[model samples]
Target: MNIIQQKKDERTRVVYIHIPFCTNKCFYCDFNSYVLKDQPVMDYLRALDREMEMTVQAQPPGSISSIFVGGGTPTVLKPDEMQFFLNSVRKHFPDWDENIEFSMEANPGTTDLEKLSVMREGGVNRVSFGVQAFQNELLSGIGRIHNTDDVYRSLENARAAGFQNMSIDLMFGLPNQTVDMLSESVTKALELGLPHYSIYSLKVEENTLFHTMYQKNQLPLPDEEDELNMYLLLMNRMSEAGYRQYEISNFSKPGYESRHNMAYWLNEDYYGLGAGAHGYIGRQRHVNVKGVNPYIEAVNQGLPRLNTLDIPREEAMEDFLMVGLRVLDGISRARFEQQFGASMDQTFAAPLEKLVHAGLLDTTDEGYKLSSKGILFGNDVFGEFIGSLTGN
Candidate 1:
């Protein structure tokens, strides 16, 4: 089916609302976020509401199946302000799926009982906390605002506020992180008995403190072998604790997988609102203006704040391969064939053949998935699809 036909007949509708305010930026973060302490917060909220209206008006779909409010730290907004923001969303979108997954990203220090309760009342049911490590010194070393106490308190507050569905983010392969420390973090996380967890390896991106430190030879990151060991340890521990590795960085108990994230992995179309947020719909992609003011002004003037491009069919097929391979289930050859009316072998002949020969990618009963080695060097395999026209 064509992009427009695919979207018009899509089984699920999702929305991603970006909240770009943070009290301070984390040293390792390169996401589109800002520490605009004195910026007009209320005005930004109003602009966000207007943006939501515009998007819905342009592409009204059926009831949304998932809604995610990701950050700069969505919990930074005060309780009343959060209510207003969420209320605007509900007013614009008539209904959400009964099992709608509404998730919000929160930092430990910025959330409290009252704030979480406001979010709960506003229809946010899932909380993902950015708890990088268990050690206070390491937390500070990474420029995290909250201490260990705040982590526990945030979980307590979430539970108290009736948020039973929750997830905690932990990082491995940090500047001085040890396997034992990773074990401790996992132990503590399990003790809380959360339904989901996202454990990611540290990646130093451009314009971040971590990148600067690396350039200066000041970063004391663990050796490659150690980082690999950390990954193995986390995988074993999580599996032993009964959490399934649904995606590369995500683990969850049965029935707790993140619907919003699954939408992306499945290559479904969704609307993304706010500065620097990205949207993919009707087989076209767009990224909003990165700065706060530019986005707000563009929204007010009825102009597209976005740089838009129609996704090439070959490119879309390649993206389907790249992202879908990240899931444990791998990409479905049948679905790919159905979507593009092209054979996978004819499309990704070179990369797939090279990878299969190297034993880094193996064809499975379901489709093609990463071999153990492929998982280690997934970036290289993904790179092969980046500019391939046949695969798109």
Candidate 2:
């Protein structure tokens, strides 16, 4: 690449750390993970530290705005281990923004007051708990290790640990979940009065136990109508609870939106490290080796890169729109024009016009956003962007 292109790429400032260990894999989970019993936890952390060193060596960045350590279950680490991991991060990425949002995903069953205290001391300002459901039976049915009590306790511990900016995740349309159950989960989560919520409809992914049961017709998930009711109910309830529906599945109490996730939706550059982590710097997109041993060995050698691709401008613009429109505010026309040097209207004329005609999209004063109808069919709207970009 030329000097000008390289200079533009230097704006990369976000960092993602992956901790690929869980107590036990959930039935619906398909993320890179392994059972935590007898795993080399310390060794993995050292490997991650090495990976971070290699990453900065490859491309030294300016001040980082955010760092998200996602899992397996990050809270699985002991208090001291958590401290070591976070400290290693600060040591490597020393020029972090003062207001940097350092978030870590925690599972309810394992996150305790002591561990959270250590995390707080280590500069973890935000916590996202994976409380998939509020009902114990449903939680067990879905292979979640934590119960409702665990969820409450985890939230309390997080709050006591000085985490005011917190987010809880809930899943709907589970094997035996109904609209009423979904509402109950939302109601319980709202009662906690956290800053943000992410309620997702369960999708049966391949290689997961859920997919196996689904293929055998053993799973009794909510029908399309019931799932639709669940979505509508949660939206209304969240709105009444004074939370804004910022994204299709995410809600936040004013100004509590996730800056790290927003970086992805805004289509900005970021650094990704650890096993199975993905990074996008400039036009090149890359994923580290998904296997833990392979990642450790590769990083020790030089870098842990698995595969890389250079995305075309048209494809990148479509990805930007697809992710940005998931937010209620939607993408900006001026930003799109500036990034791609092409007007959004002129570039995506046919699909935008067709979707708006079908009442699936509404044009705001500044740009286009998904209509209420479009949300239920968000995948379809995003599908248009992808198809239009690749001519598929």
Candidate 3:
């Protein structure tokens, strides 16, 4: 089951393009990214173009429904740089759906009106700003470069650039983040009247500065009780404010869910381009080289792959349960049967029965979904299915 390679299936409808450069790295960040100073910005963009060309040639694309450009601070690209990068995207995967979700991650202060106009003109209709927190103290404590003002100004700039579909990300469980602080942040975020919000808890990942602080007992994270309270508070707040908790950490108004992210939660295949990007196609998943120069060099010769693993059926079936349950709609029984050629209940009867008996999962006419109780303890519910089939 380890590192098995498999053929790619048809219909990969998503695209995740990565830009691994930022002005400064956040303390809690562990994504494959680099500081932008002295970096080869243009060279990386050109390499990404080459990769796009090679990737589509290999798999061939159908009409793209979603294209997401993620960080480190994609908005940091200069106007000309942004234009060139967008040109490359259009040059390669040009068959876009009429209602395609062309989203880009932007930092607050980095996106001036000029740059945002370029992005809008370049076919980016949705822009998600990374406004991690509202408090200046909290922002600075987490190594964020923008202040509270930047969030407002950036959103204003985005709207002015003709973007009506917008989103913002906020973080909780940050160092010294009180529940009151989180409440205040939520109040301010809702005031903006944005369509979507992704509020996530902080996980101190390895290779992050926060991890070192945690090891030395210096990271002042909220206690588990407060963190839970914070989560409950936001869920209540968003629900009261007419936002649906469609996924564990995401809330959106009706008809405004992030379609690009839904592709991931639905466990669909996508094209991953650029440095350190990951792509899953057919039953195979591939990751590109991490370093900026290394990715460029690899793309010059061939697909910039660090490794491509073939997902075994048992693992893939388990994956079907793990990620699919994150959505409130849960995994579709018919979808599981369609993908694996077996009945969902018959295949995962043991774990399904256990979870349903525990009241963590409620059986639906269509399939199964997390109960109200289960949503809070989602990790526990998801864990039960890990080794149910293969016992590995």
The list of candidate 1 runs beyond 4 A from truth reads 1-12, 390-392
What does candidate 3's lDDT look like per residue over 199-258, in tens digits? 999999999999999999999999999999999999999999999999999999998999
The number of clashing residue pairs in each candidate reads: 3, 0, 3
Candidate 3 regions off by >4 Å? 1-10
Using TM-score, rank the candidates from best to worst.
Answer: 3, 2, 1
lDDT of 3 at 214: 97
- Model 1 gets an lDDT of 0.88
Model 1 over residues 99-210: C-alpha lDDT tens digits? 8889999999889899999999989999999998999988988989899899999999999999999999999999889989999999998998999999999999999999
Please name the candidate that would achieve the greatest TM-score relative to the true structure: 3
lDDT of 2 by residue, 1-392 (tens): 99975774466789988999999999999999988888888988999998888788888877888999998898899989999998999889888788899999999978889999999999899999999888899989989888888888888888899999899999888888888888888888888889899998899999999899999999998899998899999999999999999899999998889899999988988998889999998878999899877877887888888999999887898898899899889888998987888899988999999999999999998899999999889999988888687775
Compared with the true structure, model 3 gives a TM-score of: 0.97
Which ten contiguous residues of candidate 3 have the minimum total lDDT?
A: 1-10
